[model samples]
Target chain A: MARQESLNVSSSPARRRGGRKPTISREQILRAAEKFAPEELSIPALAGSLGVTHAGIYHYFSSRAELVAAIAAHASRQLEPPPPGPWEDWLVEVAFVLRGHFSQFASTADLAAIGTSVTFAPLVEALLRVMRDAGFTIRQAGDASELIASCALGGAVVLQRPNFDAAALVEDLQVAEDSPVHELAASAVDDDADAAFRRRLAVVVAGLKASLEAPTAS
Target chain B: MARQESLNVSSSPARRRGGRKPTISREQILRAAEKFAPEELSIPALAGSLGVTHAGIYHYFSSRAELVAAIAAHASRQLEPPPPGPWEDWLVEVAFVLRGHFSQFASTADLAAIGTSVTFAPLVEALLRVMRDAGFTIRQAGDASELIASCALGGAVVLQRPNFDAAALVEDLQVAEDSPVHELAASAVDDDADAAFRRRLAVVVAGLKASLEAPTAS
Candidate 1:
């Protein structure tokens, strides 16, 4: 073959793409896992769909467990960064970001069922910097971080389950008939979800701020 | 043998006296579920193990879904009530209560996952009442309740995963030259699951509180 012909064969677009290009990435593998979850899926099955060798995929992620860890890391990074400035108002924004992120990747909610304890380090690190500078003591800051991440992740799982839309769940909050307060309580549950989440966040901040400013009576 | 005699013989205390009762209450069924979970378990299997007929199990639960829902509700109610006072302190207590509840029935973590959303209405209502009484607007009370509940439930799940142990996780907070801020910034991959979780939680809560109190500066 002519030099040009050999060059074309060796440096074909497909060959140059990689040693063996697969139509898949770590993200695609995770997406498939999420889509077919609660159903055991094998690397061969994933590779078959991507038209790539199983070994090629394994090159990126050493094993199934590593792939899952990557997916979790993706989720942590996907979350909207916590808003800057004051603690209260931006918390509401963070809630929206969290909710949106969880909703967009419904399957990540399942991973959360297992917990983010095994994945998601960088996100945690970023959050620690934010909290420590905000004046939380080491232990207090630690407790708070655990509390919020758990709520966000677990809440996503809770919200995404069959027959449990976020709005409908909140609507279940009607006040009792015998209570002295009726109209206002009923109205409270009726507020839009965004409004309701922000309102609730504000109360938590108020409580935290109040406690922080004054040493806890406890 | 006469029918009456046979019935009496079957009902005799000796048949049931040495071990768990021959008849299963909802609680017994749920306990069995906890023992059998993350494994393939069904109403019939549970009944067979308890030495009862499937019909008897049906008489109590009517359906497997009902049984699972009841199991979750029972676990959720077992959570200790938050102590009277500030949101931050009470939230920490709430986290501990949920953690305790999950630890006691780790197998049912997936089953009890439902209660984190649907069956939590009563708990959320109580929280809303507390927030309102603390001088938050109805909206603010609702917002705070949602955020706190989500965090507590999510945190509990993280603590209950197969690889996580709360005591060990908490112990990872000791600072070292290689990891100066281990208090709440350790990577989740460490064998020290407790410390990693504590670190992540601290940051999330601090961010959450910070988000709440401040409006985003223009």
Candidate 2:
């Protein structure tokens, strides 16, 4: 009676995990994935750490790629689109929102960098609606939203590494201190990626506005 | 004579790989990595596939991440700076050069997305030299180059996945047909990520130009 009651009380959907372990939910896999560095994600290794057979974990994900993608999708639930406002502000907020969410799941951004884009759909509807009101045609809105996300994402990827500083790169390459490359690095604030990203967004927004105002410029 | 020549023929630097296999060089790891899907990269698995132990593979690369980074760095050798010309053209060419190189090695892009910025420095000096001649302050030139790289990188990441189509995403989310997002999706031509990326670069460039032309507009 006690064993029967325990099984019933567990209430996991797929309790028969090849009879290896009683329950290993999708949530459990995602939880574990959150703790892993981007490079550390291997399905068999993930399964081993979870005390489940590799095949058992496959019940939830078709492949390791699918499994890794699901972790980002799961995290996307927490990201809410900001309320509608000025077009530039809206886009900047969206960029920041992306930075906030993906910062925790660097692998998702890494996956994007590699060739698998992790689409976070929660913000799209709101983003599209705002861009539409800002005088962009539907395609423009969609493309613009994608552009902001990409910049935000790319910026996240580039800034995620502390070693990616301009000064460090110039020095490592043996660039002369008096050269133009070194001069560019000289005036740069080494640790201010956030500020640099903000400036980047401003430039992106200005370019979009120019395109909108003078349609023939592009 | 053949046996004596065989050892000499194998001129790879690290000929001592724990006797796991007579020879496994850094070049071998890079060659293998080019064929691997990003999700399929595991140090132990890579070692096993190469008939080497994980430790033996580590003799060439200190870590899997380092191995991955080196693959990109190796490929960067082929990317040369374009001859100096119009600043805009130079920047665009640089962006294209990056796309050309990274597109073949998607994992490098993925690593940048994940938080490990892969620095490809060959073209930076020339890029800075051009930007400086175009009247940008040293910091401005550095920041602008980084911005272009980010947009190009972000665009690469977003477009790499065939499944990341706007129409498909909208359809999957059950967005209403008349809605702005759906309309954006409607105007979208799937499988034209390259065209979209090109347009995105144009906009980013325009924005940078606007910033220079009207300094306080931002």
Off by over 4 Å in 1: A1-70, A78-92, A104-114, A117-121, A132-144, A154-185, A207-218, B1-70, B77-95, B102-112, B115-144, B161-183, B186-218
lDDT of 1 by residue, B83-129 (tens): 68776555555555555554443333332244342344455556556
Model 2 - which docking category?
Answer: acceptable
TM for candidate 1 is 0.53
Clashing residue pairs found in predicted model 2: A109-B113, A110-B113, A110-B114, A113-B109, A113-B110, A114-B110
- Per-chain TM-score of chain A in candidate 2 equals 0.73
Model 2, range A86-117, lDDT digits (tens) per residue?
Answer: 98988998888877665655543344532233
Specify the highest-DockQ model's number.
2
Interface RMSD of 1: 7.4
Tell me how each candidate scores on DockQ against the true complex: 0.16, 0.41
Supply the DockQ value of model 2: 0.41
- The candidate scoring highest on lDDT is 2
